[model samples]
Target chain A: SQKIEQNSEALNIQEGKTATLTCNYTNYSPAYLQWYRQDPGRGPVFLLLIRENEKEKRKERLKVTFDTTLKQSLFHITASQPADSATYLCAPGAHGNNRLAFGKGNQVVVIP
Target chain B: EPEVTQTPSHQVTQMGQEVILRCVPISNHLYFYWYRQILGQKVEFLVSFYNNEISEKSEIFDDQFSVERPDGSNFTLKIRSTKLEDSAMYFCASSEAVDYGYTFGSGTRLTVV
Candidate 1:
């Protein structure tokens, strides 16, 4: 069976430190991988997308790295603040499949 | 910015009662989808619609669940007989293409009593 796994334990970090999250998948080769940020009772907001051919993508303070060889992706938030605290989700999709396979998501809390 | 709109932010229905959830996807999007997330669980795909028909569906999308593009702009999901296990947050999403990121609606919280 195909599975996407993220760290279920909540990650606590001090403010101004870098926060890193990992996503690992098995039995699937997706054409693209995406990251989303979701708050309580709200739908996910798109953050960034990295294609199979691309190794890394950065937008402002957020950066994503994809390693197809390892079937894993890493999401990083630089200069993290309390405002960056939220649940982050990883979604991987195949070339023709319109639907995305999402992981359980990892929760991050930046403490002051 | 454009968004996918869902009706009835929250719905409380009796078990075995039929309920319809409505959504209005972004105007220019070509693909529509329905996803559900049980409290504290991962988002699960229900069905995907394109070109006036279902392009794909997950195992969770059973015969009791149906989706329809009633009009050019509106999409709907109907549950024939609601069950306690069916209570979840149903999200509607749309995208311009299969590979593009989807814009999701605020979601409707369905609580089956």
Candidate 2:
């Protein structure tokens, strides 16, 4: 079965530290991968997107890397603050259409 | 910034009843989508709409599920017979172009009883 996986455990990091999360997929290659920040009881907010051909993408304090060969994408939050605490979701899409397959998000808790 | 708006932030429906969820996507966005997330589960794509018809839909969008852009501004998802498994947070999202990041509505929590 096609699957996208993220570490189920919550990442506990200190303020000002860099928190990293990983997403791995199997059985298919995605044309692009996207990251989203979701607060409890709220919709997921767009964070960043990286294409299969691109090595990395950055936006403010966030960075994303896509490695098609490895079928993995890494998301990093730099200078993490308490406000950065939320669940991060990884969504990867195929070559056609607008459908996105999402992984169960990884939670990050930035301690003040 | 523009937003995708959804109505009735929360709803409780009787099992076997019909329900319609409404949404107003960003005015300029060309692609509209519906996604749902069960409690503690990943967000799942239900259907995508473009040019007044469904562009693509997941298997979860069965005979009981249907989508329509009834007018210029409103898009709706109608489930003919709601089931317990249908209870989830239904989100409406829109994107200006293909592959663009989607702007999602806060979501409607549909609870089936």
Candidate 3:
């Protein structure tokens, strides 16, 4: 079975510092991986997508890198702010399917 | 910007009663999906719909469950018999196309007492 694992613990960082989160999977290599941010009592919102063939993807302050060789992906928030605090989820898309298997997610807190 | 929306931000129902969770997808999106998150758990996919028909469903979605795009803009999930275990946050999502990131709604919190 495919299993995705994130830090599964809360991460605290001082504002203006870089925060890094990890996602690792076993048993399968997916076609694409996605990251989402979820706030308390609200539905998750899509943040970024990194494809297997791509080494890295970036959106303003967010940067994601996919290392298929390691079966892992790292999410980074640069110059982070308190507004960046939320639970981050990692979902892996089956090699050629739409079904997504998500990790337990990591809670990030950027202290102001 | 277009976003998905769900009804009854919160619902409390008695066990054994039926409940309908509704959603409205992005105007032009073809793929729609339903996912649930039990308290303190990861989100779980329940079903996916397209072309007014179900394309896929997970084991969690059993005979007691049904989905309908009853009109051009509305999509719904009907639970034939709500169980206490059915208590969870039900999220509705849609994607313009498959393989794209899905936009989810502020889920409906269903509590079966």
Candidate 4:
């Protein structure tokens, strides 16, 4: 069976600092991994997707690195702001499957 | 931007009753999916639909649950007999392709009393 593990502890960081979150998985070699941001009482919003062959992908202040060898991925938000405070989820999926295996998101709080 | 839409943001139903949750996926999306998040838990995949048929479903989607694309635009999930444990937030999502990112609806919070 496949399993995904994310930090259960909430990540608190000051404004303008960089926040990094970790996602570790086992028993599966997903073709790609995705990150999503979910606000309270709302559905998740897509953030970024990184493929297994890619080492890193960036969009504005967000950066994601995938390490297939370790079966882990790191999501980074630079110059974090209070608006960036939310629960972030990681999902890993196979190449042809429409379903995704999601992790228990890690809550991030950016204090101003 | 086109978005996936779900109706009845919250639903409270009695145990053993039937409930139908509705969703309208993005117009051009080819793949549709249903996922649920129990309170304080990770989102779990329920089922995936394409070409008017179910392509895959998880064990959590047992005989009690069924999905249908009754029309060209509307997709629905029907719970034949809701249980107290059926309380959760059900989300509908769609994507152009499996590899592409999905757009999820606001979700319908189901509470079985």
lDDT of 3 by residue, A1-112 (tens): 7789999779999999999999999997788999999998898999998898999999999999999999999999999999999999999886536566678899999999
Per-residue lDDT for B1-113 in model 3, tens only?
Answer: 89898998999999999999999989999889999999999999999898888888999999999999999999999999999999999999998777789899999999999
The list of candidate 1 runs beyond 4 A from truth reads: none
Model 4 chain A weakest 10-residue run by lDDT: A93-102
Instruction: List residue ranges in candidate 4 displaced over 4 A.
Output: none
Local distance difference test values of all predictions, in order:
0.95, 0.93, 0.92, 0.96
Docking class of 3: medium
Instruction: In model 2, state the lDDT of residue B48.
Output: 94
Residues B9-107 of candidate 2: C-alpha lDDT, one tens digit per residue: 999999999999999999999999999999988899999999888889999999999999988999999999999999999999998876888899999
Among all windows of 10 consecutive residues in model 3 chain B, the one with the lowest summed lDDT is B94-103
Cα-lDDT of candidate 3: 0.92
Cα lDDT tens digits for candidate 2, A1-112? 8899999999999999999999999997788988999999999999998988899999999999999889999999999999999999999887766787789999999999
List chain B TM-scores, each candidate.
Answer: 0.99, 0.98, 0.98, 0.99
Query: What is the C-alpha lDDT profile of model 1 across B5-47, one tens digit per residue?
Result: 9998999999999999999999999999999999999889999
Q: TM-score for each prediction?
A: 0.98, 0.98, 0.97, 0.99
Give residue B17's lDDT in candidate 4 (0 to 100): 100
What local lDDT score does residue B60 receive in model 2, on the 0 to 100 scale? 99
Error of 2 at B54 (Å): 1.1
Give candidate 3's chain B TM-score.
0.98
